[model samples]
Target: MDFVSELAVARYEKIGEIVGKCVEKIEKPRTFSDVIDTVVTDKYVGIPIFLSLMWAVFQFGYSISVPFSDAIDVFFAWCAGIASRIENPYLASFLSDGFFGGWGFVLVFLPPIAFVFIALTILEQTGYLPRAAFVVDRAMTRVGLQGKSFIPMLLGFGCNVPAIMATRTIDDEADRKITIMVNPLMSCSARLPVYVLFAGAFFKESAGAVITLMYVLGIILAAVMATLFRKFIFGGSPSPLLMELPPYEVPTIKSALMSSWLRIQIFLKKAATILFIGAVIMWFLATHPWDATNGGELIENSYASMIGHAVEPIISPLGLDWTAGVALVGGFLAKEIVIGTLAMIYGVGEEGVADVITQHFTPASALALMTITLIYVPCLATLGVVRQELGSWKWTGLVLAYELILAYIVALIVYAVASVVML
Candidate 1:
């Protein structure tokens, strides 16, 4: 430790010794939190326990959200039915199928999104998240990131824009930059819809496990990439893990709800703005050629399809079809738009979206697509922030180019490995 840190620790230890001597209990008993922490922060089992807890969170989210999703699907279908009976085909299609169908499909994922945030809030409120960070700090240090980076990386689970902003708390320039660069690999919640959709469709029996694996895969890739960055791009040793662990307390219901609501509000806002607009644009493209026959016909020959086809050969080796290509293109605006774009492209309402995805993607291809979505270039907002934070278009462009290349390479490897394993 540095001289300053060593002195600081010594002082805290001395104070702790005095406090222990000053406090006495009639009955010496460890608190419930202490017992839980003993196992939760254990060196041997902490990471596995943390991972298992996350798996359970996803499992709960999927199971509980399904009913709500169905309700949304039925409501949207009814709206489409009403639109179909309208005399003005253009206005009807625009309102019912274009606006509602496109955006509503994306909204169907709100339940699971909210559920994920709620679970996260509970963990944060209970003070387990910081412990999880502490548990993983050793592994992170080996990858050129200290425990401080874990907070920003965990924030990336909600969104990358704010997560990048959160890196400002790191005092060291190299640590902050490295943390920002790797933040995208944390599997933001926006990508959860994509994972849930594909996992439910292809790996139904183990959908939660599959989604958990996607998050775990993101962490692994982030660590590997951080190690590479440390070796090649930025030559610096990681800072020591130094942070205070807050006392575990029973989280109040109001606090958990407020936390979950705050995070989920971001998703709702994006669905209303970015995803909403992207849905309309996609719907128009899919319905274009300005012909009545094409309005409700197959989207295979539409302009969007052409764009996807143009990029097909580039991503085809990864087992992603034209639709997946187009979705990735739309993903540039926001990751959630990938789900909405697929909804528009398939012309399947939210209810049938999973079945359509199942028909189009095999287990190997689905895994590849999820990995690519997790690691590909940041969203438009995140990109702007990166440029702003780095103060150089040159560095921002480098970050973008490197991420795209890394995404493709990782995705292809995943496809190849998944294919072999499935065989």
Candidate 2:
């Protein structure tokens, strides 16, 4: 037998032994009804507990990270001032605005990301994630995917690229491909800055709730879209969601913290590398011409400007202007770059654009933008993984085209309805 078969057999034997022991320990003989009652009726408690625990995690992450984020922002601002005071204007601009400002925003968000990952790691290590997956499996089945897909989908909540990679666990080719394609809709942590920034700056009292809603919406959309895809494009019977629910144990604080720190480190490195470079490039686009006055519309004259203009028409129906279009395109490279691009465009200083976004974007427009972002194309990293795992650019292209179309249609509907209601 193959490794998977062996593992499944082992798990079956283990569960059988556990059930047998339970039956023997009872004073009365246990019926089939009793087994059903134990597994089904008692499992309901896990659901609410799971949700409450998740809320606590979000609370912990936000509480722990806020002070650190503030400190980092202040330090970067001081560095920007120091650079501005230097002699050479070009070098000063590069340090203060281009490099420092561009990267500062990314660095400041690390604390919250770290906190979230740490909480998730604890959940994962304690083996509750699998139970959560089991609880949701029936709901997932209604959406035409096995319960096991839940793990990868949860991973996508952290980062879509790794989520796509996690699809390797799914043995079925078509199911795996579909999972990879839809995983990006799960709203990874990288997208949090956009939602948090926009929500906080504009809808202060409702920000947290709204951010949470957007996340929930993303999952709903993913499920709906996955169901539609399975029924039409990849017709198949739902595979049995055979999963091993490891016995629960108390999560080690040291391990949980280490896992959280590692995740934060990975996010920080990516932000410093890909996101920072993209920011500098965006800054160059906004600042070059070697003589454009500060606050001038240099974005209209630079490479980024040209690219944004090229894609603007396609995204306009979704309520995005040229600037938002540029951010969307940058998001395909890395979701975090969307904020970086916007920060560059608005000349708001790195990490300061959250405040600026609140000032500029209206409530309806912000909602529209968030909706589009929640559904748009997968990032380059995720796309590449999908291509490799599925072994076909054709499948990747199909997923890309479908996502863009869905995003546009949904965004248009949302913007129109929101506009009408708000007005």
Candidate 3:
């Protein structure tokens, strides 16, 4: 019940008891909100509407931002062209191939990321995410979680680092632990580029649908894991949800855009600091031994390639080669680096990355890739916060182990099923 409704009910109940049948009970006339909540919170349609709106959010985001992304891609390629003309070979390589090439690949994703953030901000500003929590609360209880836990998980859609931190609100240690353990299952916005690149390359017309499934998959897995943890480890029932839903209102464009900007600004700050350093290290590994590899001409001889090839046997069943291993390894530092790693290793620009990916990967493996990217270990920043919040390396290690094993099994299943279906 809303705050107003609670107050009204309290006043009337106390008065009625005092009056002792002197006044007949009243059936109040409904307001506009009463009518709207009837459908929006309906048992049958509520969850489906939630899913449909999520689909629309991505549809609006990825489709609407294509022009801006294309423009950014063109600009980066031009910058790389200029960077290539430097007098010194090593400096030229670092500037063009390393900086402009890799940075451009990652930056090409900004427009769609911005649009997705904007859409989520609008949903938040309009007060629907709380209603979404209400709709899913019954399902959450069955799976050993309070509906209120969904708030942090929803915030995880932006970044898991903060989302894990947000779990501080849960009073029960058991509840907080379970929520923290499963929160990484939410797909942070950093993984958007990987989804966009792979989905466009493989799923194409249904790219939006595929990306939506990634989000859905994360939510499902979080619930499933919460159930297992509750039954086996925690051994307690979920606390009942006791959250108040704020009344819905129209969000102003200025407010929505400003909030969205604040959300995406974190990425920009990290790109300049953590991401900048990681890119340099990756570049060195991918383009070293200027003598033997002929000044980074043959990436196959680079240290990164060697490491990737050593791990190839493990990932070969998923249809990814050494190159993908390299990218996945880089993703530990930051998810955004995954695309940049792929581009650098393949010697391709932002546009050519898709073409090259198609030649190298089929739809089945692409789906598997996307699935693993969704389910695999959280990024470095997220891991640090999880370690701190969990209070020890033991729990952190446990989370890592389960996620890796889960990601592998799920990706294997997806690969086998998609291969058969697509065949």
lDDT of 3 by residue, 288-336 (tens): 8777778788999999899899978988898888988998888889888
Report lDDT (Cα) of residue 259, candidate 2. Answer: 80
Query: Which candidate number maximizes lDDT?
Result: 3
Off by over 4 Å in 1: 1-33, 296-298
- Judging by TM-score, tell me the better candidate of 1 and 3: 3
Q: Between prediction 1 and prediction 3, which has the larger lDDT?
A: 3
Ranking by lDDT: 3, 1, 2
Model 3 stretches astray by more than 4 angstroms: 1-29
RMSD of each: 4.5, 6.8, 5.1
TM-score, candidate 3, is 0.94
- CA shift at 379, candidate 2, in angstroms? 1.8
